[model samples]
Target: MAQADVEVVEDMNVEGGPEAGEAVQVLRRVFGYEAFRGSQQEIIEHVIGGGDAVVLMPTGGGKSLCYQIPALVRGGVGVVVSPLIALMQDQVDALRALGVRAGFLNSTQDIEERRLVEAEFLAGELDLLYLAPERLRVEQTLSLLDRGKISLFAIDEAHCVAQWGHDFRPDYLALSMLHERWPEVPRIALTATATEATHTEITTRLRMAEARHFVASFDRPNIQYRIAAKNEPKRQLLELLREEHAGDAGIIYCLSRASVEKTAQFLVENGIAAVPYHAGLDPRTRAEHQARFLREDGLVVVATIAFGMGIDKPDVRFVAHLDLPKSVEGYYQETGRAGRDGQPSTAWLAYGLQDVVQQRKLIDGSEGDDAHRRRLSAHLDAMLALCETVECRRVRLLAYFGQESGACGNCDTCLAPPQTWDATVPAQKLLSTVVRLQRERGQKFGAGQIIDILLGKKTAKVIQFDHDALSVFGIGADLREAEWRGVVRQLLAQGLLAVEGDYGTLVLTEASGGVLRGDRQVPMRREPEKAARAARAKAKRAPVDLPEEALPVFEALRDWRGRTAKEQGVPAYVIFHDATLREIAVLRPASLDGLGGINGVGENKLAKYGQPILEVLAGRGTTDGGDAAGAGSGSDHAPPEPPDDIEEPPDDIDW
Candidate 1:
């Protein structure tokens, strides 16, 4: 068949059948699971029913079953090509324990062992044969799969196919060979993380452009989102570990191998069961360390970035980053490793100005593209904005990804919204510090030196340059060093500060110039600690805390949406969507004014869901109490605004 024809058939709508019914029966019998979720049945039908598809599901959302159950029904030795040896072995072993024939091929297998496995695969004795992607190009391997005509190709961690991805691999490049060699067979590329750009890249790169695309919804209600300033991070972490994550599986991320070791030791000293994992350790030691983390329950793994990518464990309750990740995608992909069981989880990070300089240095100092560097730095800046966002964490994150989210009560910012104050003067002072430091040292200083000089702290460098005597010295005496750090951080987040390593200095951006000139409205927000604490406590409540009147309606809406999605073989939100649901709840239009009563609902969506939405919100259970509030009074947790005289900007847009 032509590629376009294959595309048509791959996307052609097909409903459930007797075979699928039998598959469901067997699913309950062997796996002891009730039924399939999301598009698992359709995904399996596409793959096992002899077609192509790509599945995007969150971790612990049963991605494995999409391939596992289909492999059994396909009636051939299902050849699974994956990248990680540990993940491959875990899947293969689990299958074997279920009384099904399964095996794996990797460097771990000796020559004699390879011979035995190869012989079984050829003799049709194995139902599933898992091998590393790097090994798929070998002569003996491809020859056998070509001779036997292996079952569907399941590509786990399919996001790695995109060069723009965080975990891209070179060997994954050869995966297009599957399309060439197995043109008649189906292919399924699955990944947990792929934004719009990466999503498009996967289809183009994997040669799956002609295959079915299943994008599951991105909402993870169970995961509590958080971003905190780097205020006594060590002590803060200890308290969080003891309180919220007590006796739960978690991951604590640091930037370096030494930091991993030290932090792990510190946690151990404080009575948390933890161990370090990093590339610095010997191969044997790394293996043992990873094995222990997987085997033992609730054991925390403190490590650098190397410890990720291969982990498949579920029920990880928390993921904390002691330092900032390089990009928002890196942050999302890493933090996503937690709360995989669809249970309550936390995504927390402690960051500050130093994190900014380090990340910029790493990016500018790397061999990657200048454009990629710029984009990465911009993305990090956006994340820093999220850290300082007083609006809502979930809303900000969703906005960055080109989606809109209602206030998520589960995030720190939503529980106790940061109280805003006019900091136009402090901001002007800070911007002036940059101006003075740049001019004084012949434009040869960074934020750290400027901060020191501002706080009246004289050092050898300050004495050498006589910066202590500068007129700007002690001008910022009103604020402590920590508060000054907060100001600098907010400036960086706002694009008022830029650190280019080549300059080895802090250069004020146009935004800073405006702030200094008193021509912008500078809204300053303090660190949100109490909001985060309330979010932690409020999580004990159920998901989607709409008021009591809105429950049945939301539930009914979700059910109808779920059914529509399965029938179309698309994600739930894509059909009849979230915007449609929200308009229904908020406006309470008694009749189909065609969504005219709703603010966001336009003519197009109104034509599609105006009636359905009207039906749901009208028969309400409760209004969304909205996000977490002060538990006692449920008062607007927006922090009390600081004094008005703090600062005021000139009354016009400077830009």
Candidate 2:
């Protein structure tokens, strides 16, 4: 045979699979994408050619396509190991909608359901099969895999293999057996959030050290970063909701279950459709609320960290942290859930001195080795630095993930820059107050108490302790109360002050001596003026500039989408994302071909909902979608007691 014919024969005979270029064909035909993004094509080819790989892409960066496409081109079933059981069905359902034979087996399945899937697996009928890591430990599961061709292994959320990861799963440690048992099979591990340390841990633990690593940029520029000094957090959050994100879907993350309930109740009372999610709720309640949040539009979920791991909703307009996230990676992953469709979103946080104290105390009281405590402390320090940063927030955030970028003008600092002051003198006074209260008066106090003494406020505690007699008392009267609080917080962040005992009493650290002697200088960011903040909020809340005629069309399309999703028992975004709806509304696509041309309106979706959507746009359809639009809230308020695992400290101390 000629050289070309020989090559074709080799391609056709290789495991009786599609040709080498079949991966791209699968991408366009099955997934409905025109092309590969970033290193997707390269990753797919490497895995299909039977090479080990590791991928670290940001959330919403198309990580799934890396492995999903390879599964289609290669022979046999592609086994995906996922950590979240709640997310497995959604993943499988989405794949099925794309015309791929996909299935999942977990505790949620009945014995008959599992037996059917097992039979299919043995018959070589599945293109993609998702399994929770714990399933791999079953002898039947291992035996079933042994009976098949076993194309390749895809480990989703591979960062869980790292013990220090935000969502670590012990069962993920068992996944190393994939490499050990199926030595010749190609393996691909992927995560949306991983630091350099976590990256190393994933490789080491998964035994994929030799895998080719594909790292993508961690920056999500469409999501604006904003952090404010929490003052009356509930009211401030209400103001944020009213002024900026009115009638939008979003999430408010609290630190504890009680806080979740209270915040949810507060929002409901204020006329917002809100619900709470945490481990404390009954499992059925959590599942029901999750279903509602996913299937409905304009819903706000006030929840703890338990709420967002496998959330695939793309229209979350904002993620507000009422409590500082435990680590920068956790914050990145949580905020990444917003604007998954690349629309403008916000990552808003309300941070205060009490957050620092509470987080520190949690770390201190945690049951761990010294090394573990130090690691936790290091993570907290990074989180605090991100909040205290005066420069671009994106710059600091991306740098933590080993990528460098210029100032992103979308962040709060870049937009409404704060004034920095030479706070050396103020730092000295704050440190001196801590030292005097400790050494001279033998009275330890928190930031609030220390600030009262500094500003010459003779509260009952100061009068009782005779703190009014101290030399440092009233010396800080020149600065306002908020400024003094800022100094104390900066001092704590700088390691010049430490909280000791259960009361979170402030005590001077060894570093405090340098500042007291004028040998150290502290630069503090002055809080943005109230008027400047109001201006920025107003600017952000400016009405969308859609064409006059498009407004009604957009609303009608949303209504249609909502109804269709409710009837189908799926999320509205599953039918068509808000961005896709907006495109259709603006373009006013008149035919199936026109609708198919719009992004996110794939072949399958167009074939299914095309006519109804057209009718809705044409204003002849009396059919209903669901109510697809709603409003926002913010703040870092105190939550109820956290479950034992969440590490909330006692609230008796006056932080």
Candidate 3:
């Protein structure tokens, strides 16, 4: 914060045996970033000084710089082992643009390309070389070592060393070779997610046994968590798209290939810019979809869990799931993708009973032993508990990962708040219907048929089963079928209603004991499914086909950003992100202070561009928020946040 405090923070550094002033300068020059982010400066000094380290920084915490700066300042090339090809390319390209010597070896590279990279490596002309762990153990890789010097072996995504990690890679196991072959080379392992176990596992696996651990704060204050019951998940997701996510950068995750395609198509038909991606798709098609989502603004990509392992897109506004994730860690990592740029964003999920059933079925179908199955079930149970919680989701999520957070009042539970109603009767009716249908037809009926029987419907299946003869028949006639479905889904989430996937039968697990015995009064929303969906639909405002009154304002801001970026020689984002731009456009901040209050602007930036921006805001000079006149003292004073409006973008555009 202050100069003296910064010095104090850096003063606590440890060293293996090296100087680091040149490294700091390299950092400032190439990245235009003034200083290293927390523990980074010290971590760099430690690595360059010659000890291995493990860094646990949040996403967007600038972990890459901790290694990159030291690599350039030190005597030899930095060998960075990474898992994601996309992440590697993005990092390398960004480094190369900054005039740094960085290259990577991936499946995408031709043999000559690999040879050339290795040649540069031997010549000692490369500052850093990215390696996929899978290729790091081969003879060719070992041969490169004789010709090239390794200053440090940096392992990114170090959490992959843990079996519980969402992005676990088998290749990560080979990292022990780095320690075996080059015991002299310092290793730095970095990850955004690592509980106590994961952290311990990384160091143990890499044999960086004595690594100085630097664990930064795990606070992502900008992201909000919201979970809704799986009531018409499709429509709920659509509501999310139109509301906060309309024309915004975001990702929606589903559990299946069919759901992925269907969701993407549904979103596209509903007028959102969306596409589906999964392992089942052709690689080229998947790559194209990913590229399009990355390069373009306002694109929403719906995909299976396979997507976005190491995507570097910075402005994702929200992350929504149409189905339940396999584990809480999976959900956390995926949802963490939102608000990465330190702006407020949302993580919304609409889940239901079938998702839980499907997830359990998949886990059971796997070749794992009973112990392994129990492990999977434990993770799933935790996730379902999170979904069922009326308490703060963020607190529970962080708590699961061994971090503590107080009530944040930022999640849905802290906002509207859930009010649970006694559902004893509904629960008994649901169980009885399942039992009656299974007994009569010699098989369990799906949710629809069960709901029909409960409501006295004479559908072909229900009539054939003669389920109305059951004691619980017509007992739930007052509740709409969808409401009953919601009840059933919630029961499944609680592990009270279990499905036999192979036979498609409703087999109550032992966990269902309380619900059947009326010992558990299931808490449920009393609202009918159709009415609930309608309420959600109404809550989300339709996107302004073109909010035209704000059009000129947005164009002017973009122009200002470009001109400022050119003069300052920084990327447009270093000035302001698209979200900030959109807000500026929408609000049309009448004063420099008002502009600063819009999120990205701060006091220091105000002094530099305040007047020019204010002049533009006042509609003066060539463009308003633009100024031919130099900045003045008067422009230093700013106002409050601009009020909201149902305005439109201008017809004439500049883009």
lDDT per prediction?
0.66, 0.75, 0.68
Q: Any runs in candidate 1 off by more than 4 Å, and if so which?
A: 1-20, 458-461, 502-504, 539-655
Error of 3 at 389 (Å): 0.7
Count clashing residue pairs in model 3.
19
| Predicted candidate 2 versus true structure: per-residue lDDT over 310-359, tens digit per residue | 46666677789999999999999889877665657878899998898988
All candidates in order of TM-score, best leading? 2, 3, 1
What TM-score does each of the candidates earn? 0.77, 0.89, 0.79
Could you give candidate 3's per-residue lDDT for residues 1-655 as a string of tens digits? 0111111122222232234476665654454333454688899889989988999876656677778878988899998887767556545644554567888887788999988988999999899998888777688888887578988988887888886666677889888888878888888898877777778888888888788999876767777777777767888788777765567778888877898899999988999889888877777777677666644556788887777655545567788988888788788878877755455677888877677767778877977689878878888888988987767787898887778889886666665566678887888878867766666657666677777877888777666766666676677898877677778777877777886767445677786767778777778654323433443443343233214444455556667766775575433444554445565656666776566555434444455666776666456222343432323324322221111100011111111
Q: What is the lDDT ranking, best to worst?
A: 2, 3, 1
- The list of candidate 2 runs beyond 4 A from truth reads 1-20, 530-548, 586-597, 614-655
lDDT string, candidate 1, 1-655, tens digits: 0111111111213244445576665454444333555677778777877888888765445566777777778877777777677555555544553456788888887999988888888888888888878888787778878767477788877887888677777778889989898787788888877778888888988888888888766666667888777878888888788877777777888998888899999999999999887777777777666766654446788877766653544446788999988666677777877754344688888888888777777777877788888777777777677777888777776676556779877788878778887877878877787777677556658777788888888888888888887888877888888888887777777777777776446778877778777788788788655876686677545353244343345445666665654564332323332333443544345666634544323344456556766555544433343421222232222211110000001111010
Q: After superposition, how far is residue 399 of candidate 1 from its true place, in Å?
A: 3.9
lDDT of 3 at 411: 68
Model 3 worst lDDT run, 10 consecutive residues: 645-654
Task: Select the stronger candidate by TM-score from 1 and 2.
Answer: 2
lDDT score, candidate 2, position 567: 79
